[model samples]
Target: MILREQLITQGVSEKLLDDVEKFKAFYALTDQNLTSRVPQTETVFYGKDIWAMCISALLEEENILLSGPKATGKNVLADNICELFGRPQWNTSFHVNTDSASLIGTDTFIDNEVKLRRGSVYECAIHGGFGVFDEINMAKNDALVVLHSALDYRKIIDVPGYEKIGLHEATRFIGTMNYEYAGTKELNEALVSRFMTIDIPQIKEETLMVILKNNFADANEEMLSQFAGVFLDLQAKSRNSEISTKSVDLRGIIGSLKTIRRGLKPMLAVDMGVIGKSFDQYEKEIVLDVIRTRIRESWEAEDIFPER
Candidate 1:
């Protein structure tokens, strides 16, 4: 109810909300064991339009590919989608070593005979869970071949030596990719064609403020503004190629604030959470320069959450 009301407050369409409610009831989970797969997400995605787009696409059974740079909340939105719709989620991060067996099933010896140990994708498919393919572009092209059948219109899994099975009606897949990451490539045309792409954008300052306030109601308002300013400055610089995306991190900012509430110095927490994210000493210096423009090195917990 809170999630739905939050969406309504954000100006999500009533018609869409109605459909979402219906969709939730219509495909309600029957298998209680899968309840653990439902994400316990703390952050609600803030974009009205993005929420509507993802809801509509998923309601129509289309696969989603969230494409963009870091800190854009692609994975967050994916989690919000699955949580709002009451679906179990299976997340897999792609890498060079990822292969068909890792996604489908591998042969295992059981009861003195060989049996298949189901993988994340297979579990998601058979049980109508949401498959979150993180770093989809990082995997070698050959490693992703196993997903082709399930991703396209076919929506079937043909596991060798196992019975072919159709995806559960409630099954949905959401893939996230960062285009310029090392060892990553643009998704192939064939793979791209299977998904309805959503290009996530950086969080607006106002949106970031709302997220911050929601997470830290007791934090000083002025301090919140300064932290938000720091993030916005980094985001703008990163966008303009003045700085790398390594330091334009919304998650890092939030995490650092949490540590600040736990009695760490405000600037030092930012250093570990935000600045230290980039291992390159030169990049760290550059990010610290941006942060110091907003956060004072002498700031402490009393300066941020003085009421405590």
Candidate 2:
């Protein structure tokens, strides 16, 4: 209680301060109390501090952008942020058809009268919660226009027929995207100017191995290293345009390693990890070749396989 008051004294707005109070109370009473649950200590995530800083900035009502390739732990990073901050999160995935009504609020005809139903952004803002806008670049420019007002100095949303609502001080939006990919437009200067962008690097081999060990305690360490190496190799191929971006999946590797530990054959595990990622026959073959070559090399180094 005193801390909340102190936050208000430190220039946090009244609405946000009050919302935080409500959040604290809810946690104390609700069966699913978020505050009581401890954050994960066993799963090691490298560059985790960058996400913490981003969350801190959000607590101060600053906007942020996270740019990274697929399976770089972007969503996990977001989840950890909410867990650490003790805030509820609302997720809004952007696509070509996303519009103002989708972000700001929409009035629906009910009982012959239109009533405003808050969108994810609106609900998160008013409730002093965090919002994650996933794949923000996938949205059309017109769809993002509503955010300019919400994010900028105005810090308010005005629905013509309804009340003008100011943002709660703790309300923050985290936008995630993979900027290097095709079909993603450069974030317009106006929108780009509003955010503090953090470039998330691809997960390193050591970090990936740590994740595997934590997730699969029974797996051979050498085999886990091979799995990580395969993903890194695929990532390099993607970067070089030798293969499409979808070829690499760190999550898939972990899942397949778990399968391998459960007595699945190496080829079967590799298929589980690499084959399903592709929809095209050609892409699948390429991924399979890469996986076989890498895993074979790793196995031979341990004298477990005979070289051709």
Candidate 3:
């Protein structure tokens, strides 16, 4: 099913969809130039309740802050939300060095004349696009002070040498952060208050199996279950502080399946995708042990799936 149909079936209120359509129609009547920034994503976000909550927040014009641990589908849901609303997306990955000039814009000399180079936030604000502030807590609080006005009721971007620009009515900002990640700072209360925060939970075993089946259609149910089990086992280890999260990657599991499909040995493919992610020898050994416990070294494509 298409994204919109999936959303409606997944419990997003009909009114919310109507509101989004109305918002789009209103923008169509205006002369504002809006560039298409929608992302082409293959991942689907499950859980009807979470979909409803996100739709409710956007319809109310509230900025959303998604906080969770790594690989909990945070970025996936952000991209999915943009698709569901049919709005242009401007993804700005925040880091320690991301400054106000990067969020807003900077004056640059071009063609013998000084012109303002609009940044992600600036363009999103004016064009009614969704701005994704990825890993927001990675940046220092002082650097993010400029966002206070834009996020708050003021909804205005104050450029030092330029006129203030009001954000479009349809403009919304979504901030994502992995709270447990190293080097991430606690978001100050002032900045936190401006957004409606949601704590994204880890993907459930059933959901993980669904995702794995969707991606690895050629794999049998038992093998898919084993892959999901391995991921959950690694997740449990990380949660218990037995190892760092560097080795627990959902994407890596899918990557391994793809490599195996290409006729590579299953163990070697899993090693390249899952174990190879960690640079530390100790970490690699730990990850390899998990794989060993899950799949035997003698296992081949026939062991995981029916021969096509």
**Candidate that would win on lDDT:** 1
44-147 per-residue lDDT for model 3 (tens digits): 87777777778789888999999887777889999998876767889999999999999999999999998899999999998888999999999989989999
Flag regions of model 1 displaced more than 4 Å: none
Query: Superposing every Cα of model 3 onto the true structure, what RMSD results?
Result: 2.5
Q: lDDT for each of the candidates?
A: 0.88, 0.70, 0.85
The RMSD (Cα, Å) of candidate 1 is: 1.8
Q: Pick the candidate with the highest TM-score.
A: 1
Q: Locate the minimum summed-lDDT window of 10 residues in model 1.
A: 35-44
Q: Which rank order by TM-score, best down to worst? A: 1, 3, 2
The count of backbone overlaps in candidate 2 is 0
Q: Cα deviation in Å at residue 54, candidate 2?
A: 1.7
Q: What is the overall TM-score of model 3 with all chains considered together?
A: 0.90
Instruction: Point out the higher-scoring one by lDDT: 1 or 3.
Output: 1
Off by over 4 Å in 2: 1-44, 180-182, 239-241, 279-286, 296-308
Q: Choose 1 or 3, whichever is better by TM-score.
A: 1
Clash totals in order: 0, 0, 0
Q: Evaluate model 2: give its TM-score.
A: 0.77
> Residue 184 CA error for candidate 3 (Å)?
1.9
**Backbone clashes in model 2, listed as residue pairs:** none
Candidate 1 on 1-308: residue-level lDDT in tens? Answer: 47888899999998998998898898898777888778877778888988888889988889999988777788888888888889999999998889999999899999999999999999999999999999999888887877899998889999978889899988999999988678997678888899999988778978889989988999999889999998889888888887788877888999999999999999889988888888888878888888888988888888999876
